[model samples]
Each structure stands twice: as structure tokens, then as C-alpha cells.
Target: MKKRSVVSASLLALCLLTLSSFSTADTLENIHQRKKILIAVDIGAPPYGMLDGKARQSGSDIETAQLLAKDLGVELEVVPVSGPNRVPFLLTKKADLVIASFSITDARKKVIDFSNPYGVIQVVVGGPVKQKIGAFTDLIGKTVAVTRGTTSDMELTLGVKEISGVNIVRYEDDATTNTAVSTGQQDYIAAAMSVIPAVKKANPSRDVETKFIMKTFPLGIGIRKNDPELRAYLDKWVQINLKNGKLNDIYKKYFGVSLPADMLN
Candidate 1:
């Protein structure tokens, strides 16, 4: 009887250990078990992610998320997010990941983890080629358009103080900001270089050209801070795709050019 009691106690402890292991499985494992992953992407940001003519989400970031889901052998569920809400969605558990052209910054690093940079983008000032603005200083006393609450808006807002009398006009979105510039509602517009091709394509008669680059920043996949397993998997995924030229292929499909060599570095 004593021997049987001891054996039963041992089996109970083993079962408890197994249950604890299952309970503490990392996020990647959970995603696999659930057979789906929720990805947050900015549907308004074109070339990166945006809505199609049918109002379905489609773009480079959407394609990237689809690839991730395929690799994971799971279903992809896209959650539309904006610039300010992307991080919030991740932190609030509304998204399993964010691939919304989120730039890697020291401040963001404090709140969320970023995977290895998968791409790079340039923030630039663009206007009619005939416009006299040549540099940041030239914007003084001129009105510049930018998407509200974006990095371009922040950068231009902060930097313009050096050149007194500049007027910054904030628009609700990039399309609106581009329209404001193309229609001469604003003298210049600050935007990502990636969006330039689309802008020119839409307004073929407009001679918009980059006046000067404001900044170049690397974009990374946003992940939860504590999910080391998921972070490691995503880092490896980026490295493999980058080395295999898959990422460049994707970029070319959207941007009409291969990824820049500097971006690879």
C-alpha cells in the first residue's frame, strides 16, 4: 500500500510539471497552436500598406505579413492601425506583431522590442521642381504640408524653429498632404520618399521633385518586449529573406527598384 501511494504521488507531480510547461509556452508556440496571427498594419500608408480599389488591405507590408503567416503555416488577420496606434495595439494585445513601417527609435525601444531592420526609408521634402526652396532653411515664411502626427511632421515642426516664420500645415493623411502640395495649397510637402512614385503617378502633370532629404531611418517589425522566442524567430526570418533576395524582390514589386545597398547594411 505504501509503495502504491508513493507511485501515485510521483505521477501527480509529473502531471503538474507538464501542465505548467504548457501554461508557460511562449507566444510563438501559442500562435502556432491558435493557427492564426494578428498583424497590425497602417492601411493609409501606401507602398508600405494601404487599401485597394475594393477597399481591401494590400501593399508591401500586407504582403510581408502574408509571407510571415505562410511561413508560420497559420492564417493572417490584419488589424488596421495608424501611426500613433500601432504601438498601442501591440501593447494592448490587439496585435501579435506590427509591420507598419515602424521606425526603430530609442524612445520606442523603451516600450516595445524591434526585430532586425527589414527595410529603410528616407524622409524628404518634395515640391514642384520650379519651387525655389532648396533646403530646410528655404522653408522660412513658406507653408509646408505634412501628415499630422507623423515623424515628418515632428521633425519639420522641431527643425523649422531654427528658421523663423515657417508655417507648417498638418493634413489628416499622406494622400491629403500630397493633394495639398500638388494643388498649390501648400508650397511644399514633407513625406517619405517611398510615397513619391505613387504621388507622381497620380498627378503626372505635377513636376514634384525631392528638394532635400530630411532623414533616413531603418524600419523594423514591432514585437512584444518579453517575447524573446518570437523576436528570435522574426530576426532569423528577416536575415534569411534579406540574404535570399526575397525582401528585395518584394520591394521592387512595389517600388519599381531593388532595395538600396545601404539599406542592406
Candidate 2:
């Protein structure tokens, strides 16, 4: 009787252990099981993500997400997000990861992990040719427009404290912010370097150009901090695609220039 009872207890323990393992399947496993990977993207940010004339999703980040899903043999489900909500979406499990031109910053790193940087963007103060800005001090008395809830906003906010009378106007999206600059609502905009050409196209009279560079930020994939499997996979995936020229192809297709060679290296 004792021997039989002991054997039953051992079987029960094994069953419980097996159930626990299945219940704790990580994010990658869950994605595979569902046959879909949800990637958060900001469709409002052009060059990084946007809607084509036919209403199709197209851009550098969109293509990168598509490549990720294809390589993983899963369907891609994009969760449209803005700059502010990308981290929230990840924290709340709304998506597996964010690839929406997410720049890696110390504050963000404290809350989430970033895969190795796959690209870089120069944040600058863009203005009309008549307004000159050779240094940060030049921004004094200028109203700078920036997209709310973006790194550009945070960095510029901090940067202008020493320069008195530097006003900043915030907009909800990149398009609106660019419009503000083109329409003379703001003399300058703190945005990616790509914004200059966009602002010029919106209103040729603006003739926007980079006045002064705030800083260059490294763009990376945003994942939950504790996700070792997803983080490792993404880091490797970025390096592999960078080396293979696929990522650069997407970057050049949108920006008309190749990614920096160092990122590939």
C-alpha cells in the first residue's frame, strides 16, 4: 500500500510541473502558437510609417515589421500607435513589440529594453532660410514646433531651459507639426532631418533647412524589459538583416539614402 501511494504522488508532481511549463510559455512561443505577431507602428510618422495612396501600409518601419513576421512564419497584425503610447502598448501587452521609429533613450531604457540600433535619425531645428541658427543659443526668441510625446519634444524642452524666451508649440502628430512650421504658426520645428524636405514640399516658400542639430538618436525595437527571448531574437534579426542589405534597401527606398555603414558593420 505504501509503495502504491508513493508512485501516485510522483505522477501528480510530474503532471503539475508539465502544466506549469505550458502556462508560462514566453512571448515568442505565444506568437508562434497564435500564428501572428502584433507589432506597434506609428502610421502618422512618414518615412518610418504611413499609409500609401491606396490606403495600404507602407514605409521603412512597416516593411521591417512585415519582414519580421515573414521570417517568423506568422501573420503580421500592426497595432497603430503614436509616440506617447508605444511604451504603454508594450506594458499593457497590446502588442509584442514596437518598431515605430522608437529611439533608445535612458529614460525609456529604465522601463523597457531596446534591441541593437538598426538605424539613426538626426533631430534638428528646421527653419526657413531667413532664420539663422548656428547654435542652441540661436533658438532664443524663436517659437519651435515639436510633436508632442516624442523624443524631440523631451530633448528640446530640456535644451531650451537655458535660453530664455524660447517658446515651443506641441502638435499631436508629425504632419500637423510640419504644417505648423509651413504655415508660419511656428518659425521652426524640432524634428528629424527628413522634415526639412517635407516642410518645403508642403510650402516651397518656407524653404526649410536644418538650422542646428539637437542630436542624433539611435532607433531600435521596443520590447518588454524582462523578455530575454524576444530581445535576443530581435537583436540577432536586426544585425542579420543589416548585414544582408535588406534593411538598408528599405531605408534607402524611403529616405533616398543608404543607412550609415557603421550600423551595417
CA lDDT, every model vs. true structure: 0.83, 0.88
Candidate 2 regions off by >4 Å?
1-25
Candidate number achieving the greatest TM-score relative to the actual structure: 2
Task: List TM-scores for all candidates, in order.
Answer: 0.83, 0.88
Candidate 1 residue runs with Cα over 4 Å from true position: 1-25, 182-184, 262-265
Q: Per-residue lDDT for 1-265 in model 2, tens only?
A: 9999999999999999988755532889899999999999998787788888899998889999999999999999999998778999998999999999999999999998899998888888887787768777888877889999898998898898777888899998787888888887888889888778878877888778888888899999999866788888998999999999999999999899998888988
For candidate 1, lDDT tens digit of each residue in 102-150?
8887778998899998887788888878977777888877788898877
RMSD of 1: 7.8
